[model samples]
Target: MRLALVTGASRGIGRATALKLAQQGYRVAVNYRKRAQEAQQVVAAIREQGGDAFAVQADIADEAQVMALFQRLDEEDKPLGVLVNNAGILFTQCRVEDLSAERLQRVFATNVTGAFLCCREAVKRMATQHGGLGGAIINVSSAASRLGAPGEYVDYAASKGAMDALTKGLSLEVAAQGIRVNSVRPGFIYTEMHADGGEPGRVDRVAAMAGAIPMGRGGEAEEIAEAIVWLASEAASYVTGTFIDAAGGR
Candidate 1:
C-alpha cells in the first residue's frame, strides 16, 4: 500500500488532511509533537472508515526527532509516496519591534527548519536517485506569506515565505526524478491555530479585515484538505512547483 506522512496530524488542517488522504487510499503516518491521544483518535477514525493509519510522535523542529520519525517509518518497509509539511506555530499578537530574537528563532525553528528537515528525509526515501519511487510533497503555507501579516505575525509570514521558496526550488530540483512539490495557502481558516495566536476567536473577529473574500467567509479545514489531497493524487500528475490559494478569494 502507498504511504503518506503528515506532520502535526493530531489536529486542525493536519488532522483533516490525514483523514482525506486515507480516503484517497494512502496508509497515513500521523505525526504529532504532543497530544498523543489526539493523534491516536485521528488514527482510529481513519481505521473505522476501513482505511489504514498509524500515529507517530515527533517535534518536527528537532533534527534528531525528525530523523527518528522517518526511521520508524523506514522500519515499516513501505515506500513513502506523499509528504505533507503541515506542522507550524504562531506566537501571540505583537509587532516586529516588540518581538525578541528568541521568539523569532522559535517560530522559524518549527515553521521553517522543521519543514526543511522533513523534506530532506522524505526526498531521501522518495527520490528516484536514492533508488526509491517518486512521490509528492504538499506544503501547508499561509496567505500571510503574501499579505505580510503586518501587525499580527510577520515572523510566521516570513517563515511561510521561505516555505514557498522551498516548494518552487525543490519542485524544479526533483521534477526529473518524478517528484512533485506544491503548496496550499489557506486564509482565515477556523482552526485552533488562531487560539495559539492568543485569540480563540481570531478568525471570526477579523474576517472582515481581508476587505471581502468572494466566498464571503473563512475556509474550513476540510476545504484545505481537498486541495492537499489533490496535490498528492495522480490527478495532479502533471502539476508541480505551483500553489493553490484557498483564501476565500481574498
Candidate 2:
C-alpha cells in the first residue's frame, strides 16, 4: 500500500483524514508535534479497524525537525504517495493592526513554511524526474483566506492565502513531473482549532447568525476529510492546481 502522511493528525481534520486514508488502503503516518498520546490513539484506532498506521512526532515549524520527520518516514521503506500538509497554527482573535510580528511569524512558520518544507521533501520522493512514482499533495487551507476573518484573525487568513498561492504555483511547477498539488478550503468547521482562536463555539456562533453560513450550520471534520481524501485519490487523477471548497455553499 502507498504511504500517506497527514501532519497534525492528532486531532481535527488531520486525524479524520488519516483514519479515512487508512480505510482506503494506505499505510498512514500520523504526524504530531506534542500530542504523542493523541497521535498514538489515532494509530491504535486504525489498527483496531484492521488498518495500518503509526504516529510520528515533529514540529513542522522547525526545519531540522521536518528533515528528521521525513528521515523517519524513510525508515518505514514506504514510497510516500500522499502528503497532507494539514499542520497549522493560528493565534487568538485579533485585528490586523493589533497583531504582532511574533504572532505572524508563528502562524506563517507553521502554516506556510512548514508546508513548503513538506512539499519539498514530498516532491523529491514522488517526482518522476527523481526516478520515483508520482504522487499527490493535499494542502488543508481555510475559507478564511478568502473571507479575510475581519475583526478576528486576519493574520491567520493571510497565512492561508499564502498557502493557496503556494498550492497553485507548486501544482504547475511539478505537474509534468508526475506530481499533483491541490488544496481543500474548509469553512467554519467545528473543531478544536476554534478554541485556539479564543472561541470554542466559534462555528456555532457564526452559524447561529443568519446568513453567516448559507447552510445554516457548521461542517464536521469528517466532511472536510472527504474532500481531502477525494483530492488525493485516483478519482482526482486529472485534477490539480485546484481547490475543493467544502463550505456548504458559502
Candidate 3:
C-alpha cells in the first residue's frame, strides 16, 4: 500500500482522515506539531484495528521543521502517494482594526506558506520527473475562503483563498506528471478548532442563529474526511484542481 501523510493528525478532520485512509489500506503517517500523545493514540488505534500507522512530529510553520518532516517520511522507505495538507492555525475572534501583524503573519505562515512547502516536498517525491510514481495532494481549505469570514477570521479566509489558488496552479503544473491536486472546504464543522477561536461552541452558536447555515446544523469532521479521502483515492484519478464544499449547503 502507498503511504499517506496527514498533517495535524492529532485531532479533528486530520485524525478522522488518517483513520479513514488507514482503513483504505494506506500506511498512515500521523503528523502533529505539539500533540504527541494524541498523535500516538491515532497510531495505536490504527494498529489495534490491524492497520499500519506511525506518529511523526513537525511544526509546519517553520521551514526547517517542514523539511525535516519530509525527511522523516523518506526514512520510512515507502512510496509517498498521498499528502493531506490539513495543519492550520486560527486565533480568537477579532475585527480587522484589531488584527495584529504578528497574528496575520502566523496564520499565513502556517496555513499558506507551510502548505506550499509541504506540496513542494510531496511533488518532489510524487512527480514522475523526479523519479516518483506520482500521487495525489488534498488541501484542507475552508468555506471562509468563499464567504470571506467577514467580521472575524478575515486573515484565515484570505489564507484559504491562497490555498485555493495554490491547488489550481499546482494541479495544472503536475497534471501531466501523473499527479492530481484538490481541496475540501468545510464550513462550521464541529471540531476542536472552534476552541481556537475562543468559542468552543461556535458551531452551535452560529448554526442556531437564523439562516446562518442552510442545513440548520453544523457539519462533522468525519463528513469532511470522506470528501478528502475520495479526492485522494483512485475514484478521483481524473479529477484535479477542484474543490469540494462539504459545508451543509452553506
Candidate 4:
C-alpha cells in the first residue's frame, strides 16, 4: 500500500484529509502534536473503514520532534508517497501593530518553519535524487494570504504567503526528481480554528460577508479535503507548483 503522512491530523481540515486519503487506499500516518485521543480516534475511524492507519505524535514546529516522527516512520520501513502539511494555528484577530514579537514568532514557528521542516524531510525521502520513489506534497494554505486578512491576522496571512512561495519554489526544485508540490487555499471554512482565534462563532459572524463570495457561503472542511486528496492522487500527475483556491469564489 502507498504510505501517506498528514500533519495535525487530529481535527479540522487535517482530520478530514486523513480520513479521505484512507478511503482512497493510502496507508495513512496520522500526525498530531497533542490531542492524542483525537488522533487515535482518526486512526480508529480509518481502520473501521478497513483502511490501514497509525497515529504519530510530533510537534512539527520542533525540529527534534519532527526528526523523531520520521524516525518512527523509518523504523516502520514505509516508503512515503504523499505528505499533507495541514498543521497551522490562528491567533485572535488583531492588527499588525497590535501583534507582539512573541506572537509572530509562535505563528511563524508553526505555520512557516513547521511546514518547511516537514517538507525538507519528505523531499529527502521522496525525491529521486535521494534514491526513493516519487511523491506529492500538498500544503494547506489560506485564502487570507491573498485577501491580506487586513485587521485580522496579517501574521497568519504572511505565514501562508510564505507557504505559497515554498510550494512554488519546491515544486520547481523537485519536479525533475518526481515530486509534485501544490497548495490548497481554503477560505472561511467551518472549523474549530475560529475558536482558537477567540471566537467560536467567527464564521457565522462573518457570514454576512459571504455576499462577496460568488458562492455565497462558507466552505466545509470536507470540501477542502476533496481538493487536497485529488491533488495528491495520480489524476493530478501532470500538476505541480500550482494551487486550488477552494475558497467560495473569494
Give me the candidate number with maximum lDDT.
3
lDDT of 3 by residue, 36-114 (tens): 9999999999998889999999999999999999999999878999999999999998888899999999999999999
Q: Of models 2 and 4, which has the larger TM-score?
A: 2
Output candidate 2 Cα RMSD: 0.6
What does candidate 1's lDDT look like per residue over 115-203, in tens digits?
Answer: 99999999998999999899999999999999999998999999999999999999999998889999999998999998888988877
List the candidate 2 regions with Cα displacement exceeding 4 Å. Answer: none
Total clashes for model 2: 0
**Could you tell me the lDDT of residue 102 within candidate 1?**
95
Model 4 Cα shift for residue 246 (angstroms): 0.7
Model 4 agreement with the true structure over 154-200: per-residue lDDT tens digits: 99999999999999999999999999999999998999899898888
- Model 4 misplaced stretches (Cα beyond 4 Å): none
| Candidate 1 accuracy as TM-score | 0.98
Which is better, 3 or 4, measured by lDDT? Answer: 3
Superior by lDDT: candidate 1 or candidate 3: 3
| Model 4 TM-score, all chains together | 0.98
TM-scores for every candidate against the unseen true structure: 0.98, 0.99, 0.99, 0.98
